[model samples]
Target: MIDAIMPDSVRTAGRALQVWDRWLLGCTFVLLALGVTMVYSASIAYAEREMQNSAYYLIRHVSFAILGLVLMVFVMHTRIRWWEKSGPFLLLLGIASLCLVLVPGINAHVNGSSRWIRLGIVNIQPSEFMKLFMVVYLAGYLVRKQEALRNFTQGIVMVSLVVAVIGTLLLLEPDMGTLVVMTVTVFAMLFLGGVRFWHFMLVLAVGLGGMAVLAVISPYRMGRVTSFLDPWADPFNSGFQLVQALIAFGRGELFGVGVGASVQKLFYLPAAHTDFVFAVLAEELGLMAVLGVIVLFGIIFARAFVIAHQAEAAGQLYSARLAQGLGLLFASQAMINMGVNMGLMPTKGLTLPFLSYGGSSLLASCMAMGLLLLIGREARAAAWGRT
Candidate 1:
């Protein structure tokens, strides 16, 4: 009835909306809903003890999820050309925010890191925005420098320098997790942009070597590395977090003890609702549920690559690179978060994309997913044009 009353153009767009990527959209919402449930479960005890409100974190997480969904819808409707054009500006804004967060008296210091700006009741983390903006900037750069990318001086060196600058700024915030994600995402984009294999390997070696040196120079990072190697060696101190995480997994066994039945979240596991939320999830929901979550992420990553390939095949280099970069960002972050939870990697302050309780990370992830959907829509339109 509404369609009958609407104009033909409106009806046409409604039909297009009906054909948007259902798999991507469906997986995103499922993870989001699951996240809300797990967050409430993981945070209720802590919230009650600290704030006298059992719904504190859950309320905030849901509010941010709603806001992120709105931003996602807006981005999905906006033209891809706008993002391509505004890429540089967004990058500059991200850099400026990073700088602002490091300034004394302006920055919000929390847990020994100056990585956020306090806004009344909320703390805004700039590094999260940096990941998305860096992807956008690099996507545009890859398109504009496609021809030059094969050359060391024009392509690899220039991009590396840009990444280095971003890394330096992030390290000042001391956000090693975001820096790792950003570096990997950019390198993946360059490789997909057809930089020579040897050049890619040389740059990768140098980047990894530099990170190793940074880790060695930092006492805390070195402790994390050593503790990760043998978490049981100092289980009470340096390895406390990882050891608790492993215990959550061990308790989970095949099936979870049941939702809200987790003992680990009772002040036993650090960051049970934030960085280690996945561990709490495993404890309450079990190995089966954890595997399901992993499969959902795998599907999202696979679909991203499929969309990227379609865009590339349709001759949309900008769209292709953007999709590729988003794929890398999501996949790498998810892997890192899960790895840390399962004790496969050293702990870092990275959130599970759609499943962790974080406003900035959720918003940035929704934006990335929205762009992927937009790219898929355009690819379909281009295909139809050829037909």
Candidate 2:
């Protein structure tokens, strides 16, 4: 047993594992910290004005972040197989919660939309959690049907039916923005899973047609479409918020007025703490800071794609597809929120990922990140055979 042979494979594998783990964990903490600081800065003015306590929103956000951090650690430490195995059950629970939010006396109606469940101190938006659950569920389903995925009938029918059913519920809430994002997430996953292109196109056409019909049937939606074209036309009415958002951005030049120094938060921007938080961010932090936010999200997208590539190379197709889909979901939502704030797109009540204020959004987004971390870890383990 004294051969003293060299094992180059083991030594090289160990180095690769170390590198992956370092990159993934470092990125996770950096993103979380950025979220906390930005959320606190973005919400302070609204909190002081509305609640008469500047620390109110900050404390709540910190508490939620702590809770989310715990959940993240739990997910990261847990077995990847567990998430894959439990995907179906979680999907069922998510669907049930989504249904419960629709039932009278059980749901909380905020601003004419019944999208939450009030449980005394906390109101939970099931849709936020539903997104992560759907991602996990679809990932598992696609992997299970990898062979059948090549078949037109089974693949399109099953996938299309799920999207249609979920799309109806979200549309009934009249959450057109979220419905569109969710449809994009599912189709993105399906495309990554090797579904035929023509089938996906058929689904897209139907979805676009449905959106057009909904716009006609709903007067408010039609108004939004009109406002999108020329918000200045109705400066004092339907377009007020859009015009105000533009003003906020214009006020903030290269360098912002400084943190907690946004003028728009003084009632100029409606939904200051929620949907339009990005405008407040721009007003306070300036255009440079706004660009920074975009860049940070860009880094996240790039890292996620790296994970996907690694996972695919390792032959873990489900993890790769799920990771990629989630990256798209998070990045796309952020862009949509920012675009709406900048008046580049029609406004819908979508929160900016990570930086927006909301308990459910915070918790659900953290959970998605947890799942993302798990995928990244699995990729590392697969590539280098390390735990």
Candidate 3:
């Protein structure tokens, strides 16, 4: 009825506006739905073996998804100024949580790395929340110091110091994967914030150089690099995970065996429901599933930048930077996880954003999406001349 009264041009513009906000929310829902189904499929065997309950992970995941959705709604409704003002405190709180994870008794140590904090029902990964906080904190910082950021010393140095401190704490947890993602995302945000090209390049160079040194110095990391180069070299040992993942992909071929029918997730693939869920997904759903997931993410990644541009046009610098940072955060993590599964990159303990079975990750991704929605709402309002 509304469309009938409007002119054709106005109706088309309305559809264009709907495309941005609707696509973001729509793609996220699709991913989250897929996450639930895939998590159950990939974890059924493990959950049954470990917890004696076939639906253990499924129940927990549903619980967290509900919680995350609730939180996302709250975040979207909250005032923007509140988030901007709270960024610093949230960043400091994230730093504190990271510290807590390193302490004895309180920290949940797993696979030689201390990353989670036992929160009764769920073990929360501080690094996940840290990424969100860093984006929020940095976005606000960039907006506050826009002019200063143009200067090499005042802007870049100050931000780098904070990131360095966070990186050191993350290294203490030995979460090099999260550290790399966080660093790269920060660098990408810096570029979007309009930092000088050379300064941005310098930061990128230093970050890359530091990663190389860290890899060379650490036997475990170096082994990963070597194994990634040739997972077949020691297929039953260090390269076991990637080799199994590849096997799963090969089994998947073009179409997939069937849901809940992945042989690899039965016992061969480690972290089947977590880091390697994509492999299990491929084995069960085939190449078409992979392409679909990639396309959905492509829409999300591209739309985030559109929202950022919209925010910029609306004179919302903080929102613009936040959207960009969050966009890179999602895309980088997803790409890295998929790359690892495909044997294109060294194995990293990164979740595939909304698609992985991790409470912290799901919650963080939801909150980030909520913020994007908030920004998008304001931009639309500003564009439409609404109060």
Residue-level lDDT tens digits of model 3 in 288-307: 99999999888888988999
The residue pairs in collision within model 2 are none
The clash tally of candidate 1 reads 1
Residue 305 lDDT in candidate 3? 96
Off by over 4 Å in 1: 1-18
The TM-scores of all predictions, comma-separated, are 0.95, 0.91, 0.94
Which 10 consecutive positions of candidate 1 have the poorest summed lDDT?
2-11
Q: Rank the candidates by TM-score, best first.
A: 1, 3, 2
How many steric overlaps are in each model, in order? 1, 0, 0
Task: Rank by lDDT, highest first.
Answer: 1, 3, 2
Cα lDDT of model 1 by residue, 110-155, tens digit:
7888999888888899899899999999999988887888899766
Q: Taking the tens digit of each residue's C-alpha lDDT, what string does model 2 give over 308-339?
A: 89888998888887788778878878888888
Candidate 2's TM-score: 0.91
Structure candidate 1, residue pairs in collision? 256-286
